[model samples]
Target chain A: MNIYEIEHNREIVHPNTRMADVIEADYRILPLLYRIGIELGFGEKSISEVCCESGINPNSFLLICNTYLLTDYSPSSELIGSANPSDLIKYLSSSHSYYLNECIRELEGLIDKVASDLPANQRDLITTFYKVYRKELENHFSYEEDIVFPYVRRVIEHKEENEKFTIGTFEKNHSNVDEKINDLKSIVMKYIHSTGNRFESMQLLSTLYILERDLMKHTFIEDHILIPMINLLEQSHDSQ
Target chain B: MTANNKRVLIITPSRIVAEGLITILTQAGGFTIERVISSISRENENLLHTIPADIIIADPSMFGFNILQTLKNRLSEFTTAPLVSLSTMPMSRTIAANFDEHISMFDTAPEIVKKLRNITIVDTSNSEESQDNNIGELTSREKEILVKVASGHSNKQIADQLNLSVHTVITHRKNITHKTGIKTIAGLTVYALLNNLITTPNENL
Candidate 1:
């Protein structure tokens, strides 16, 4: 089953949930586990045990996993309060590297392989569109890393307040990176005539779809979890 | 030129004009001059078919005042490069209208670059719109159901409100999903808000 279908039927990962069982529920969570510095050799270890061993806050780990895996899972203020901002940031930043270095690079390779079988103009168009999309993804990640994350970190750690720069500014300027992926998918679906390399084309399209869904979940965590936690920090700093 | 630079094909009769434009484009820094040919002739017509270009800058004199027809005859069936007019002298609106963009001789380097960049943006967006069109438009009934569905109404509720059976409502919803390629209710709602089928309270104000 795909992640969405799994999400519909799967239970939320909790402190007692086995690391192996979580992957069995939805293998997509394996990447999330790796990003948060969790490794294999679960050996019947539960989520909390594995998180403690990795030095990751269990609450933060569970929050990220549930928010990612469960469609109905919304991070309440209480839930957000239970998690550590530093842990969340580490996970998110790791996610950025994972997306840029691994996911996007893999996509480029697959697109090249798929495009090799297409006509010259179509090949150029496909590769060109992918290149543009990759650049956009890079810009999005860099903005988060350079501007947003540092500001959030300062607010959480030093209680620093800057009126000119806030999470609100980031929220306003946070362009939807997934929409362009959707556009690329539609373009490929409509234009590409992969008669000989049908399997490769499907592979490329599926990877694009997975990336789009993964990005949506990534943005969800940012908007729902990260932003609220930072907002609370900003508010507390103001009162102090 | 870097691999990501916009590939621009220059087709002007004056060598001096092409060189000047090329220098300005190089300074502009996101454009690669793909080719520079004096004019389109019988011998060089096939070059247009073979050369990969993101944008085309051609003098109207090269096409004998018939830009669209000449380009159609020369370019391959798949070529969709936005034709830009490199105006050396005063040209009539009718002749200028044939080109996607017009660049005058008196234009500064930045102005020329801006026009070229704008062409690329327009070209990309136009292709996106065409791709969107390939999904096909919803029928009037499908649109009606889509608005209601986006408003967070269930199929039974929609059926009751629209004076139709729930089965019919479900069918319409399926058609909407099939046409738009958006499966989830949330995705459809966002699509509706984007397309302005349903407006939020903030937008109502």
Candidate 2:
């Protein structure tokens, strides 16, 4: 479940309008919505309680479908455009982690159901794609919650919050990309892609195509929608 | 003490990464961790199956379970799910062991913690008595090797711990591996724990 699936299901009232898509996006409010959900965890609200607090209906299939799509990529500061680290957890969970869980449950069933649809090779390719997708998806989400967002929030809120810090002593937001993503990309090409194994060459290619599509869009949300909101939140919090 | 706090579950294979993670996770205080499983175990498995934590939080490393199946198949029966395999060791065979079972695809730790804490639902019914830390299967020599390994001592260190030559320790390592069918020191420690072979490490992990 990547961004393509969400965008692909757009049921705009008018197919003739360019604005119909983003406007019809069920995901339009996810950035802010997820931000709140993340904060709820830090403060008092359980995530599910927080998601319901905003009335987004986490159990909905469209939301579930969107959740699945958003699971394959990360929410980068560059990617999401700079949210307070505090808001990042919410932004990520609301916008990403929440969706990923939905995808995991859905994909587990889907893969099991579709196990018979493809040959061993195709199934293997699909399985491979799922593995890469889940791993990258989980890893990226963790960065925001455990590292990136927490760093931003600490920077944004500073001593305005607490001394010991609920975020504890960890801060990964200061890390450089050279330390993180590129090497990850290499592994994706290796084991997940089979490094050009004959058994999954064709099927793996298609799997990669779908993954690339979802990852790009997921990156789009994190890079575009969520990060900007964080920047805005940081500004507002600082001004207060 | 810092060594005991290496609580993260990384899944990459690079020594650069293994060294890198040792630097990072050691600073965290919640629990201690290291690669206790194998990386190939993460391939094509359920993302949940690979999680070695009470929860899971990962990234796109499993668009197709590319690393998902391997981890899941191993822990298909596990319910509390304690392995947290990261997808990027380059995630590694050593770091892979730290995870619940496979490699995580995502890049951050906050997100991982949040996800595991909130989303991953442990099926309590499926969890087993593996948590019992009272197995009594090891002999006195095996106990010595077990303690040394659990304390982060290398085989040579264990040999020194018991005043035995490294060769004797190597023999012990083989016997331990053969008797328990566990290769990594981490695995043997875990085996010791499940069978009550030794007292469990402090819950600080």
Candidate 3:
């Protein structure tokens, strides 16, 4: 797939465009997005059913559907916080952080489930590589919340003096993410067609099936969350 | 045969791909394999570090170019054994990704076998100039290294960049000069650049 290009533009894309606009622009990519939605248990079926099966909130599903019109699926909750400043900032500090933490927790577990399933011999290595992924995602998200998010809220609400430094740091973090994505791509490739079999090849394939699904969900969160947050940060800076 | 008889360790990311290659590789019977590692590990990190394989058949299509890094990290350990990554598409992205390493990429299984045959048989005794024009020309591995050297990278930088030894880089450079009769790194580099081998500064093989 052309996932490399999409991932490369991880921090790119207009901040204010509704998800609908982004998805429409990438109509060809929609089928893949739909498959991911179904894979993530957000099938074309009713949001209620998907939520029940996957245990996700319906509002979030709607939000993702709203986003998929222009973007891939949904704006990250972090983006929701950044959409407004005063109330969202304080709430983000306490509640939104918890929500995000929960998402990360589930994502990590899903990744493990997927990795444990890969065969000792297979073409791809991406089954359940949560350790490397979680470590990076955790660090990245925490940095955004503790450092960048706070700066974003402050700049949007109060025009803090030190925001440029914070924004600069957020932008620079993209390079590291690029490197991480490459690593993930490596793991994915190990799965795609890179496996060298020993004994438990079938077991590995089972693990891969699950892990691949988990990764799709995982990327949805980041692409939806980080991309919008970066845009908000940029806009917040531009306004100041 | 079985795992007990597996002598060569084939590291890849896919079981299907590994099996297909093993089936094809064994069709001729010149070499026998022992194990196939489908994961990316320190043990299978690169061709350079993995237990020496009689032949390595890689599939980097799904992984983008990380397979090339393994190859780049591998090329310097030795230059003789065959490390071939077969892709549905030829001229592997790994070649583009790990431009400084020694790994060959092919589009089809037959091409991969042809390359292995050439390596094992050493059949090019009389056709010296024919090496450059035919499939043997540039060797995906050399092309990778040449792309880097051509782009103004120092031997040390090339070594570190490709995970090859400085001695190996120098040796390759010397060999390239000798084979091409270019006489100098600058000339060799100019020749490489002119040939569209490398462009950007960080274009790793």
TM for every model, in the order presented, reads 0.54, 0.27, 0.31
Cα lDDT of model 2 by residue, A123-219, tens digit:
4434544465466567767766666565555655553343343222322122211111222222233323233344334443344344334444444
Q: List, residue by residue over B114-166, the lDDT tens digit for candidate 3.
A: 66665554345543332323222455656777777666678899879877777
Q: Of the pair 1 and 2, which is ahead by TM-score? A: 1
Ranking by TM-score: 1, 3, 2
Weakest ten-residue segment in model 3 chain A by summed lDDT: A1-10
**Local accuracy of candidate 2 as per-residue lDDT tens digits, B125-162:** 53332232223454676676766776577867776767
Write down the C-alpha DockQ for each prediction: 0.01, 0.01, 0.03
Query: Candidate 2: which stretches are off by over 4 Å?
Result: A1-88, A159-217, A225-240, B1-205
- Model 3 residue runs over 4 Å out of place are A1-130, A162-166, A176-240, B1-156, B159-205
Lowest lDDT 10-residue stretch of candidate 2 chain A: A1-10
Tens-digit lDDT track for model 1 on A1-240?
Answer: 110112222347678988889889888887888888988887999988988999988989987887667654545567789889999999999999999989988888878887888777556656765676678789889989999999888987875656599987886687567866765665556545768778777887898888887887788788778988888888888877
Highest lDDT scorer: 1
Would you list the C-alpha lDDT of every candidate in the order shown? 0.72, 0.41, 0.45
Model 2: how far residue A117 lies from native, Å? 3.5
Model 1, span B1-205: residue lDDT tens? 5887998888765777877988898887998777776544332343465566888888886454543565653452335567888887787777777788898899988898988887777434223212222236887777888788777788899989988877566656655654666554545554565456775512111
